[model samples]
Each structure stands twice: as structure tokens, then as C-alpha cells.
Target: MGEKGEVSAVGASRAAESRKIINVVYLITALDITWIFLQLSVTPYLAKKLGFDTLWLGYLQTTVGVIQLLGGPVFGRFADLFGARTALSLACSSTVVFFLLLAVANHPAMLFIHKIPTVFMHVLPASQMVVTDLTEPEKRADALSKLGLCFGVGMIVGSMLGGHLNTRYGETFTACFGAVGNVFSLLLVLKFIPRTTKDPRTNTESENKSKSIFNLGEITRLMKFPGVTPTFLVKIVAGLPSGIFQVMFSVIAMEFFKLQPEQNGYMMAYLGIVQMVIQGGVLGPLTVRYSESSLLIMSIGLTSLVGLAQAYTQSVFWFCVIVIPMMFSLSVFNVITDSMLTKSVPSSDTGTMLGLSASVKNLLRTVGPTAGGYLYMNYGQSSIGLIQFLVNMVVFVYLLLRPLKRTEARKE
Candidate 1:
């Protein structure tokens, strides 16, 4: 009877811990929402104010991408070496300052300085790492889906609120909106996440043998594992279109559709709603029903088809209809792909691997803005759609031809 009581107490403790973690995820959604709000239109507004065009906007994104590519790994290593909570707290605190910089900057060039600090102090990867650390193996994908829902819901609120604010308040002052979310995220990190949870692998090793964050050899050795490389490539390729589109969307809507900031906000809100419904409520059950390989392949193929459908769509009504499948597929793909990658590596390296995942996306994102912007300017807005369609096709065909490699899974 005493043993059963002890087991019951343990179960209760775990349940309480899980609830706290989920609450942390909800707080993260606020941050994601604020971010989406700022990016929806404020970025382009600043660039145009500085006498820049789509190409210049692309340049800014490229610069951010380059910085993120390098800094992402460093932060990942920080989370691993120190702890996710420490890294996340620092990231949240850094974001508060970064937004302040954006809010006060007189010139567009100053935005680059803002992104420099952000390169090393990002919360998304760190936050995901936190959830990864707490979740069970079978439930990680579902847990990740909940994270995705936060992003989706945040997008809905952020985009709509951003539109309303941008229309009413103008650009520069509105930059501080995300800072509000940062305050809350920082508080949550300080209060809930543990100060340190050192990796056993590093602890077992000699202090001098611990790898440096700046060491190229360390990063190279990380990829030496069986499933890491291919998984990274798949995520990069599958995610590129969305990455490009994310930066380009506001610009495209403004130019092609002649949309007001509020209208653009509404469109993004609609997209967010679709993402929220699918990722938040439906992803877990669907994950149970299908293998990651099958779902990924199907989602990629259908997403390409949806891109093709969008290329031909001129009206907002039809565009709204198309957003459903696109959001569903992309959200599902992100969840499952992340699950696959995290399972590919041991627990100790989860932070590093997740950071690498962000780096690859950022690397591709560096080129995405410039290329996507130029294509939008010189070719046509529809051209961006065509490019996405083709890219998605390539990814789908490659995945279909190759057997999805599931390396020996080891839980941390």
C-alpha cells in the first residue's frame, strides 16, 4: 500500500510538472504573436521609410539570416553547456532590449544592430528545447504540435492586433508591441524553468575535453551521426518556401493586392486560425494514425499542389480557401519533422540539434529574401508562387524516391 502511494505521488508530481510546462508554452504563444505582428507589416514600413525597395528589404532579411546562422549554434551550445532555462532567460531579456532598439531607431540601418544581439539570443529554439526535455518519446510530436498551435494562435492575435495598431499608430512606436510579450516570457523562464540541467555526456567527460561553442570541429562531429544530415536537408528544403513567403507576404499583399495593413493582418489571422485548428486540436490524433514518413510525404506533395493553386488565384476569396490545406500541411510537417530529427539524436544533444535545425532554415532564409524579392519585383508576385510550387515538387519527389531513414532511436 505504501509503495502504491509513493507511485501515485510520483504520478501526481509528473502531472503537475506537465501542466506547468504547458502553461509555459501558452506564454510562448504571446511572444510568437507579437513577433508575427511586428513582421507582418512594420518591417517593410521601416524599409520604405528609409527609401528602400523590395530588394533592400531582401538585403535586411539576408543580413539577419547570416547572423542567425552563426549565432543559432552558439546559443544551442549555451543551452547544452549551461542550461536551457539560463539560455532562455537571457534570450527573453535580450529581446526586450532588441525591441526597444527597433522602437527608437531613426534609420533602417539601425535594425541590423538589433538583429545582431538576437542572433545569439533567440527564444524559439530554446523554448522548443525546454519542451523536448520534459516530454516523453511517444508524446514529443504531439507536444511539438501544441507549440505550433501557440505560434498559430499567436499569429492570429498578433497579425490582427498589429494591423489595427499599425493603421492607428504608425510604424516606429508599434515596434515595442513584442516587448510586452518578452516581459512575460522572461518572467516565466525565471520562475518555472530550472536553472540548470547539465548534460550527462559532458559531465562524464574531463572539463578540458568539453567542446567549445565556436569550434568548427565540434559542429562537424555533431553531424557525423547517421540520421542528422538527411533530416536537416529535408527540413531545410521543405521549409524554404514558407521561410521565403513569410518575409515576402506583406510586401506581396501590399503590391499585388493593394492591401491595407489591416487587410493584410486579417489575411494572416485567417491563416493562423487554420494553423491553430489543425495543429492545436487535430495533430496528436493524426500523428497516432500515421507514420512520420507517410504524413511528411503526403503533406509536401499536397502543399506543392496548393502552391500551384495559389499561383492562379487572384481574388482574396479563393486565396482564403487555399490557405486551409497549406496551413494544415505545413503545421503537420513541422511537428513530425521535428519529432523525427529529435528522435534521431540522443537527449543531451537535443538543444544543439534543434539549434542546427534553426540554422539551416536561417541559412536558406538568407537567400530566400533576396531571390524571392527579386522574383517578385522583376518577374511577378505569381512567380513566387511558381517558385514555391517547384521547390515543393522537388522536395516531394526526392522524399518519395528515397526511403525515409529511421536511425536507431534513443531517448534522452
Candidate 2:
């Protein structure tokens, strides 16, 4: 009886510790995302001040994308090897440097130089790794959806804060604010997040033998795992159009909508609010009621429809109204895909898989911006929606033709 009670005590203590770590992860994720949207709010004005044209802006994102493409898997492997706390520290440190450079940037060359540190900015992937580490397989989808809630909160606050500061002060002040926020994030990671114990499932001897950060062989081997390839392909195909739209959105706001910085901030905040409601209030119940495959298919279909609606909308009011379903679809789709990918791999490779996923999106960002810029310049904003509509429709049809295998599908 005494032995059983001691075991119960140990289990309870471990559970408490896991919950504490998860809560800290949520806090750090929210803070980091806040800094991101905050930086985004002022980047357009800074680009204009530096005399960047639309094509130049595309080139800027492409530069960061190229660096991240090389770094994503490395950082993911780093997390897998060293643990998420270490990876988060490195990412936060890079962000602080990036922001400081942005604050002092006076020319387009400086802007390009500043993005060099983005190679280590894998905060989101690392945080996702931490969550997957702690959560159970059956509850993973619901747990991951809460990250979207953090994202929404950060977006709402960060957008509003950045816009207010930039409008009231200037771009430099806004950049400095981001730098400070990330410094605090770094401190939180170091102080609050506990060092994770090695998973019993991990083969320490083999992992130690392959500790090189950028092992293409290892990444390739992981990709060959059952269900990984097709899921990754779907993520890339479905993500490309949205990725392009996101990278070029500031340009769209400035040129097409004629939005000033504060107005753009408010628009982002509105979108954030919708996302929060869906992820926080709506998605938890939906995940409980339906299978992930059903949710994935439904979200894709809805997103394709939203894309078609966005193609014809001319006024800001109509655009705002249309964005509600768009946010819901996007939030649902992202959570489901990430959950599925993590579950498909062994416990050891979660970070690496997420890193590969990040690399895929970064690859899209690298090419999508340049193409999106040219298309937006020549064909107007409607072309963006047209691409989204067409790509998502194809993907939706593909999913219908061949649904995910049982291995990939979440157990209800």
C-alpha cells in the first residue's frame, strides 16, 4: 500500500510539472508571436522609407526564406538533440539581434543584412515540439489548437501595439520595442522552462552517433517514414497560396486598400479576434465531435470558397466580413496538419519533422513573394485570390479522391 501511494505521488508530481511547463510554453509562444506581428506592422513603412519597391520587398522576404530553408532542419534537429529550451534560447537571441539591426537600418542593404539572423528564428517550431513532447496522442489535436489561441492573442495585442507606437513615435521606436520584448522572451525561456528528461523511447546511442546539425541523410530517412511524404506535400501545396498572400499582404494594404499603418494594425487585430474565437471557443468542441480527416477536408473546402469570395470583394467592409470564415478555415487546417504530422513520426523526431515542415513553408515564402509581387503588380489584387481558389480546389479534390490512411488518421 505504501509503495503504491509513493508511485501515485511521483506520478502526480510529474503531471504537475508537465502542466507547468506547458503553461510556460503557451506564454512564451504568445509573447514571441506578439513580437512578430508587432514587427510586421511597421515593416512596410520602414521599407517605403528605405525606398523599396514591390519587387524589392519580395526580394527581402526571399532572402530571409533562403536562410531559413537551410536553418530550419538544423534548428529542429538541435531541439531534438539538445532539447526545446536550448533551441528557444537560440531563437530568441537571434530575434533580439534582428530587431536591433532593424531599429538602426538606414538603407535597403542594412535591411537585407538584418535578416541574416532569421536562420535561427525557429521559435514556433520549437514551441510546437515542446507541446507534442508533453501531450498524449489522443488529446494532441485539442492541445495544439490552443497554440492558435496564443497566436490570436499575440496578433491582436501586437498589431495594435506596433501600430500605435509607430504612429505615435516612429519605426525605430517600434523596432526597439520588439527587441525588448524578445529579450524578455529569452529570459523567460531560461528561467521558467524546465530541462526536459530524455524520452525512454529515444535511442540515445544512435542519436549521439548522429549529432551533426545538418544531416541530410537523417532528414531524408525521416521523410521516408510512413504517411510523412504525402502529408508534407499537401501542406506545401495548400500552404503556398496563403503564404504568398501573407508575405505580400502589407503591400496590398498600402497600395490597394490605401490603409495607413494604424488602419492596417486594426485590420490585423480584427482578424486576430476572429481566430481567437475559433481556436479558443469553437475548435475544442469540434475536435471532440469529429475526426481530424473530416475537419481537414471541411476546412479546405471552406477556405477554397472564401478564396473565391475574396476574389470579387472590392470594399474593406466586405473584405472584413469575408475574413471570418477564412480565419476559421486556416486555424483549423493548420492545427490538424501539425497534429497529424507529429503523430505520424516516432517520439524522437517530432522537432525534426516540424522543422522540415517549416522549411517547406519557407521554401514557398522564398518563391511566392517574388511571383506574388509580379502578379499583384501586373494583374492586381484579385489575382492573389484566384491563385488561392485554384490551388485549394485541386488539393480538396485530391483529398477526396484518396483519403489519409488509418496510420495517419487520428483515433477517435
Candidate 3:
């Protein structure tokens, strides 16, 4: 009876810990809504005030991408070396600085200089690290997918609030609002997120051996893990087409769609609703029902179809209709890919791998805007969709021929 009681106590304790970690993940996810909120509320207006054209806007995104390309891996390593709480606090602090800079920027140089802090602004990756740390391998995809609920909520709330705030007040006021929100996020990190201890899954020897954040050699070694390289390559290649579109979306909305900040905000909210329904509600069951390889192949194929549809879209109504499948596919692809990468590596390296993933995405972002701008300026918006269609179709075929290995089934 005593032995059984002890076992029950341990199980209960673990269950409680799991609950606490999940709650923290949700809180972190919610706090990150501020980023999308600021983007919708103040960035567009501020860019216009600072004399940014579409190409200039692309330059701005490239600048951010360049910084994140460097920062993502470093911050991820920091999380591995230290803990999720410290990394999150650092990320939130950078966000606070970024908003403060945006609030006061009167020149293009100031706007450019403000991107410096983006090197550490990796709240989402750190949150993923936390989730990967605690979740069961099979459930990791579902748990990660659920983080989109916060994103969807932020999209709806942040977009609506940012639009309303900007319309009523001004871009500066909205910027201040974002700064305050980030400050609050930092406080939440410090207050709620626990400090790192020795997790059983942690490879203490490796941790002790490598404490440097800028260890490129160590970072490169992560790819050599059994299933990581192929999965990472797939994520980059498969994601590039949509990445370009997303990077240039603000410019497209303002130019082609003739949307004001308010209208764009509404559009984002609509996307959020779809994302919430698919990611928050549908993806959990799907992950349980299907293998990651099957889901990934389906998403890639669907994305190709959506790209073709987007190429011929003549109005916002049709664009909205097509984006339903687009969002569903992209959301599924991201969650599954992330889950697969985490499963490929040791638990101690989850943060680093996630950070590396973000870096690769940032790599795409760095080039996506410039490429998107050139295509949009020369060939027209239809070119962007056509490129997406062609690229995704090719990738889809490649993936079908050589399907991703099921990393989840492998023993660590």
C-alpha cells in the first residue's frame, strides 16, 4: 500500500508540473500577441511617415531578417545553456526596446537602427523550447499546434485593437501601447516562468562542454543528427514560396488590394479566425489520426493547389476564400515540421534546433522581400502566385518521391 501511494504521489506531482508548464506556455504565447498587434497597428503608418515605399519596406523586412538570422540561433543556444525563462526575458526585453525605438523614430536611419534588437526577439522559439521540454513525443505536434490558438486570439484582438487604437490615437500612441504590452510580457516571464534545473533528459556533459552562444560549429553539428538535415532542408525549400508572399503581404495589401491599415487589420483577423479553427480545433485530432509524413505530404500538395488558385484571384473575396486552405496547409506543415525536428534531437538541444529552424526561416525572409519586390514590380502580383505554384508543385513532387522519415518512431 505504501509503495502504491508513493507511485501515485509521484505521478500526481508530475501531472501538476506538466500543467504548470503548459499554463506558462499559454501565457508566453498570449504575451507574444503584442508583436502582431504592433505590426498591424503602427508599422505601416510609421513606414509611410518615414518615407518608405514598397521596396523600402522590403528593405526593412530584410534588415529584420538579417538580425534574426544571427539572433535566432544565439537565443536558442542561450535557452539551452540557461533556461527558457532567461531566454524569454531577454527576448521580451528586446521587444520592449524595439517598440520604444519605433515610438520615437523620426528618420529612416533610426528606424533601421531600431532593428538591432531583433537579434534577440525570439519569444516564439523560446516558448516552443518549453513545450518540447515537457510534452510527450507523440503529442508534441498537437501541443505545438495549440500555440496557434494564442496567435489566432492575438490576431483577432491585436488587429482589431491596433487598428482602432491607430485610428483613434496615432501611430506613436499605438507604439507606446505596444511598448507597455512588452514590458508587461517581460514581467510575466520573470514572475511566472521558473528557472532551469537539471532536467533528466538534459545531456549534462554536452551542456557543460559547450556554454558559448555563438558556437557555429556546435550549431552546425545539430544538423548531423539522424533525421534533422533532411527535415531542415524540407522546411526551408517547402517554406520559401509562402515565405516570400508573407514577407511582401503588407505591401501587396496596401498596393494591390488598396487596403488601409484598418482594412488590413480586418483581413488579418479573418485569417486568424481560420487559423484558430484549423490549428486550435482541427489539428489536434488530425495529428492523432494521421502520421506526420502523411500530413506533411498532404499539406504540401494542398499548398501547391492554393498557390495556383491565388495566381488567378481577381478580388479580395476570392483571396479570402483561397486563404482558408492556404492557412490550413501552412499551419499543419509548420507544426509537424517543428515537431519532427524536436523529435530528431536530444532534449537538451531542442531549443537550439528550434532556434536554428527560426534562423532558416529568417534566411528566407531576408531574401523573400527583395525577390518578392522585384517580381511584383516587374512581372505583377500574378507572378508571385505563379512562382509559388511552380515552386510548391516541384517540392511536393520531390517530397512525394522521397517522403520524410518518421522521426517520432525512432528511439532517442
Candidate 4:
């Protein structure tokens, strides 16, 4: 009877693992497709169309970041008490509604107000929990890389498709398609993600211990975790520059190169293509062989160079060419940061840590766009790129200041 029971348990465990893997794949694909239209294509287009100043863009992101800071812990704990799938589903659905609103948002303030809650509470927290729920410690980075690849590929396709659609059909039509894509993604989640009590925090005897509901305290504890502290600093600096770049891409295209909306979209599409190839096709496999620290350092150095290149470039082709390495570096850095955090964090705390990290990152990025706008307005395009390059240099130097032993461990 004992042997028979043990065999049965083993069979059940295998089945459960299989189910989790399937669910992870489904979630990754769904989110990837939806995010393409939301982030890379629509947001920039809207920024340009609405005539949002750099300060307004910063204010918008800052509000989101602040909300993320306030809400991340709450959401993270919620995932722990309830389940990741439910939390993720709610977050994704919320994003759908917010992005749909962007379709008709004519006022900068209106769009900014709508975006704050979406960025802070929904997008970052959900993504962190979903990835943590699906991956093991050793394989966390690998798993995240795969997930990132899905999004990268989706962005590549989405940018091209969105640009083409907007040019051919119109922004309204393209946004409708985006809404439809998100609806399909939500449906996929409902169908594929099973309701399971699979958090590593639960004990062996209580593997099926059904919890009451989400809690906020769990998230607070997660924010205080040692593993996440350093990464927060790095994320803040990186996000500032990235956020600025994100908000101003269209503006730069218009003012500097005198490119049309469709042409700007095309450039983004090309950049997305490079990111897709680098992140989805090349980076993951290389990660297995090289350590995270090496990759992180290299990504930072190259990104700085790319920033410098951008500062000097006057022609559209040169600007586009420089973007290739920039995107690649960004993707690699994100992968490494996530992987490191996952490995260092305790299983129970993954959701909270992820949320907090995102909150901080969003907060920092929020500063960038607004500041970039002011800088561009006052100093011109060359000055903006030069300052961004300086920011990257400081990041590089700060990381170097850490002890060699810890840095080496991070690579491992």
C-alpha cells in the first residue's frame, strides 16, 4: 500500500509540472502579443500626436512610478495569498482597458492620468509574478529570457504590423486591432492557466492548503529583501534614460530628422527587429555559457557607446544603425537583472520583490522623459544624447565600485 501510494504521488507531481510549463508558455505568448501594440507602437505615436511636453511625459511616468511604489507590495502579497494566475489575469485585463482609452485620448493630462495606475500596479507586478510562478531557481534566468524573447518577437512583428496598419488603415483601426488582440490574449489566459495552489511557500503536507485571499504585508516584507536592494539602484538609473528615450523617440524623429509618423514607425519596427534577433535568437543561448555579471557589464559598456554614437549622428540611417546595439544592450541588461533577482530571492518573496523592483524602475524612468524633454527643448538634440551618455557612464562606474567577489558571484 505504501509503495503504491508513493508511485501515485510521483505521477501526480509529474503531471502538475507539465501543466505549469504549459501555462507559462501560454501566458508568455499572450502577453507578448498584447504588449507589442501597447508599448512599442501606440505609446510613442500617442505622445507625438497629443503634443505632450517632456515635463508632462515625466509627470505621467512619475505618477505611475509612485503608484507602483505604493501598490507593488500590496499586489505582490496578493499574489502570494491568492495565486499568480488570478493576479496576472486582473492586471492584464486592466491594461487592455487603459490602452483602449489611449486610442481616443486627445489631451496629454488625460492620457497621463490613465497611464499611472496601469504602469504602477498592473503591468510590472503581474509580469514579475507570472515569471516567478513558472520558473525554478536555477532556470529562472533561462525562463525569463525565453519569456522576454516572446515579447521581443512580438514587438518586432507588432511594430511592423502596427505601422503598416496605421499607415494603410489609420490609428483608430490599428488601436481596434490592438484591443482585439488583447481580448484574445485574455481569453487564452482563461482557457490555459489552471487554478492551482503551487506557491513554494506552502508546505509538503499542505501543498493543497487553500489560502483565504491576497494580503499587503507580504509585499512589504518582500521590498526589504537584501537581494533586491542593489538592483533597485541600477534599475533607477537605467530607467531614467530609457524612459526619456521612450517618450521622445517620436519627437526626435520629427524635429531632428523631419520624419513622418509612418517613417518613425518604420524606424521603431527596424529597432524591434534587431531587438528580436538579439534577445530571442542570440542572447539566451549565450547566457548559458557566459555569466550574468559579464553580460551585465558588457551590456552597460555597449549601451554607453551607443548613446555616444547617438549624440554624434545627424543622419537617419546612422541613427537607426546606432539603435541596433542600443536595443540589444537594453534587452540583455533586463534579462540579467531579472535572473539575478530571481536566483537571490526566496521563493515566497519573488512576487513582492519583482513588484518592488518594477516600481522603483518605473519611478526612475519617469524622471527621464520629462528631463529629456526639458533638456531637448533648451539645449537641443545633441545635448540630450550627450547627457544620456554621461548617465550611462555613471552607471558603469557605480557597478565597478562593488567588490570583485560579489560581482563575480553575480556572473555565476
lDDT of 3 at 73: 87
Model 4 reaches what TM-score against the true structure?
0.82
Per-residue lDDT over 1-412 for candidate 4, one digit per residue giving the tens place of the 0 to 100 score: 9999999999789668755655555455635454654354565566667876555655665666566656666666566555655776676676677657766677777676666546323544555556655555555566676666666656566767777777787666676677677677667666666554355334342334334334444445444656556775676675566557765676687677887656766776676677767776788787888877777877877777777887789999888778878888888888888767665656655665666666666565556556777788888777766766888888887767761123221211
| Candidate lDDT values, in order | 0.77, 0.87, 0.84, 0.64
TM-score: model 1 vs. ground truth: 0.93
Q: Over the stretch 1-412, how does candidate 2's per-residue lDDT look in tens digits?
A: 9999999999899889888888999999999989999999878789988899998999998898899998998888888888877899999999999999999999889999999999999999998898888888878888888989999999999999998999999989999999999999999999987665336556564466488877788777778877888888888888888788888888888888999999999999998899999999999899889998888888888888888988898889999999899899988888988888888887788888889888988998898889889999999888989889999999999899998764552221
Per-candidate TM-scores read 0.93, 0.96, 0.97, 0.82
Selected candidate, larger lDDT, 1 vs 2: 2
Q: Rank the candidates by TM-score, best first.
A: 3, 2, 1, 4
User: Where is the poorest 10-residue window by lDDT in model 1?
Assistant: 198-207
Q: After superposition, how far is residue 317 of candidate 3 from its true place, in Å?
A: 0.8
> How many angstroms is residue 293 displaced in model 2 relative to the true structure, after the best TM-score fit?
1.3
Model 3 root mean square deviation, Cα atoms? 1.4
Error of 1 at 93 (Å): 1.6
Output the better candidate (3/4) by TM-score.
3
Q: Indicate the residue-level lDDT of 296 in model 3.
A: 92
Query: Highest lDDT, which number?
Result: 2
Compare candidates 1 and 2 on TM-score and give the better one: 2
**Pairs in steric clash, model 4:** 293-411
User: Which tens-of-lDDT digit does each residue in 207-312 have in candidate 3?
Assistant: 5756788888888888898888888888888888889998888888889999888888898888889988898899999999999999999998898888889789
